[model samples]
Target: MKSTEYITVTQLCTQYKVTSQWFHKLHDTGLIHITTVEEQPCVSLQAIHQVDKIMRLHQELHVNAEGIDIILNLLEKIDTLQLEMNSLKSRLNIYDTEQ
Candidate 1:
């Protein structure tokens, strides 16, 4: 599979050994994101990464789908907060230089 190109739902499920219902559930819970290709759902490399992380957590931590969702959400929130913090720090430094 091409790393840069998006894959169909079937390809994702086959590659990950999951079912369509499972994939859609993951998407609905925000644990993974999907793209549309010619009216069919497609998954990206980024989505594959997210799903891989979720799968690892599920296997290693014995987490259920709900737990996986919570973990992924927190991880995403942390990433967002970190970016916001960095932006604020940059702005503060600019202000400090003028003062």
Candidate 2:
């Protein structure tokens, strides 16, 4: 599929070997965002990675939906903090060089 293409739920289910009900459960639990395309539910390619992570957390780690939600939120916060740290380091370097 093209990079700009949105994948349908059926395509995701077929590729991941999961059921529609499972996908719906993930959607309902806010683990994944489902977009509507031509009245059919679809997922973006960018979200595919998140879906995979959720699957790993569910199947491999046996995490429940609530736990997964917390894990994902923490991960996102970590990412944000890392980015902020990098920006701060860059600013510090600039100030140090000017002094």
Candidate 3:
């Protein structure tokens, strides 16, 4: 991957005012992914928004890592369900228009 596509963990920590331990907790709980780049750990740019949300949840809401993991899983499931619902509605509309 390109260096431009990932931000160093230290940069993220400094930007978000979070500790490396927080990043490690999120990584260990499978909330965020970390990879070593040039001997420095980094996270994908795509994950930055999620990292921001995680930080907000932890720093603002006082949610623990495990709780954040569960919350994220539930949110993902809801997103999937909403997409399925939209697809089903579109399919049903197609059938309705045929009548």
Candidate 4:
């Protein structure tokens, strides 16, 4: 598909100073999603932040792909729980006001 919101895998590799294999590893581990367009693999603009995070964790923090996967999973859980807690707190406040 013709879209302005995606960067090709080759472009991402060069821009991020990482190898194509690295991106493949990330994809294999489910850390990032890849879409193939015009027979070329690309990532969406919305996932750039996540891609950067994965790279930083691997390059700077020396985390492996598996480690990155675990870290990401934990982060997702934390965010989900935080949202649930906020929702519960709002409901509790409403009940308190009714008392």
The prediction achieving the highest lDDT against the true structure is: 3
- TM-score (C-alpha) between model 3 and the true structure: 0.85
Q: Give the higher-TM-score candidate: 1 or 4.
A: 4
Q: Model 1, 1-99: lDDT tens per residue?
A: 453578788886787677888878877877777777777788886666777788788767888788998877898899999999999999999999998
The deviation in Å at residue 17 for candidate 4 is: 1.5
Cα lDDT tens digits, model 3, 26-70, are 899999999998888999999999999999999899999999999
Q: What TM-score number comes out for model 1?
A: 0.61
lDDT of 4 at 50: 92
lDDT of 3 at 81: 100
Pitting candidate 1 against candidate 2, the one with the higher lDDT is 2
Off by over 4 Å in 1: 1-4, 74-99
Q: Write the per-residue lDDT of candidate 4 for residues 1-99, one digit (tens) a residue.
A: 576778899998998798999999989988889998878899999999999998889889999999999999999999999999999999999999998
lDDT agreement with native, every candidate: 0.80, 0.86, 0.93, 0.91
Better of 2 and 4 by lDDT: 4
